[model samples]
Target: MTKTRRIPFVVANWKINKLQSEIAEFLDNVNSKVPSQTVVETGIAAQDLFLADMVRATQDSPIHIVAENVHWEDAGAYTGETSPRALKDIGATYVLIGHFERRKFFNENDSTVNLKVMAALRNGLRPIIDVDEDMSKYAQFMDAEPSVAQVASALAGVSVDQIRNITIAYEPTWAIGSGEAATSEQAQKAAHLIRQTLAKLYSPVIAEQVRILYGGSVTPDNASALLQQPDIDGVLVGTAALDPVKFLELINIAKQPSMPGQFDTDEV
Candidate 1:
């Protein structure tokens, strides 16, 4: 695959944790310290209740507020579901559609995931579509059929123009919250397959342009190796992101220059 200059993105999926008071404290600690988005894009995903507040708190910072999930319809009788339109209106720039937890706990399937992806796009919210691959099966074939299929299904009917606004995250189910992260080589292999899938669905140029992130148990100690992988543009962190200090550390790590051959690019 040819190289491209995709900015590194470090996002924290707070995922149903933190109180209002704790949220305020966390923001106060990291908001002023965050690097400019141009250097390293940063985001924090939290419960729906805290999205608006988080948006306001980070207004002066580069930290983009991300929604964990959004309903397909702009507005409906769907009780307890977040409206994509409302989320956009409330200043959420990004939304996490088809997260592992949402799929595991709330029965989110590929069909529903596609709906949410389209809905988020329709409402001007960029969807960070999560594709959870079961890595234990990775060795059977390097093609990564399940992960590739998930990407195709989630992007069904999405247009080329809209595709630029989307980001794909590969969070292997086995590593998520298990305190074990994929080896750098393993993460790179999965990310490469996802990118290749994009090349087939869209175009090789578009595939290189899209930023793919690695998630599941990412931390400062292990993040550098993962980030240096040619295909991994950034990370979708979980527990480690809960702490303001660790969160800042992750951003700083992303801001560092890539090692030689880590990024091979010519102007797209």
Candidate 2:
């Protein structure tokens, strides 16, 4: 069966930033301006303290409330950890797992990422799994081992049916928060490699059905080129997303249809 085209997903990862008032203002500025989820899906990953409020604020909007992180266990005594169940119950529909920063600073590894992915699925939260790659490996994607290996490991016990809900993000560790973004060609190569990895893990048809995003210093200025990549379904934005106007601009760029010659149905 021919699958429907993947909807562009523009997610803002507000890592440890934004106060309550700021959050409200950001929402107020973008809520009605955001395109419909059907046209271009939008999400905001913020601090746990603000998720419920965000959900409430976007209740009439199509913007999905996203959690920055989630704990593996649904109900656990892991103090300070945000349970997946709690996140779902509080109205968060998506959660970022194994973000490069989390793996680098909080000791989040393949094992923990896998646990959280499954946990989020069990509790009805979509997992936007972030896989960071080295620029050297990304250049010669055929030898890109760590990123592919991380994808395989993260979905270790995930069933084929559950895979449909997964959205893999390719964020090069070197470019994140550095004000340097990868060239569009480089980003496309990385996203294609990730899709190829998905094909190997499941099937080409299933792989084509999956959504892959590129992160690391994505901005309105660079987004059009990046979004033109056939394999790049959307962007996991950072610094630039903090500004509502820029965020809306990025979404508007995504709203534009893919350019001619960008094959959406190319076989894996």
Choose the strongest candidate by TM-score.
Answer: 2
lDDT of each: 0.89, 0.88
- Candidate 2: which stretches are off by over 4 Å? 138-147, 259-268
Residue-wise lDDT of candidate 1 within 92-205, one digit each (tens)?
Answer: 999999888889999999999999999999999999999996544545656643347789999999998899899999998989999999999999888888887888898777
> Which residue runs of candidate 1 sit more than 4 Å off their true CA positions?
1-4, 135-147, 259-268
Model 2, range 162-232, lDDT digits (tens) per residue?
99899999998988999999999988888888888888888877788788899999999999989888889
- What TM-score goes with each of the models? 0.93, 0.94
Position 223, candidate 2: lDDT = 92
Clashes of each: 0, 0
Worst 10 residues of 1 by lDDT: 259-268
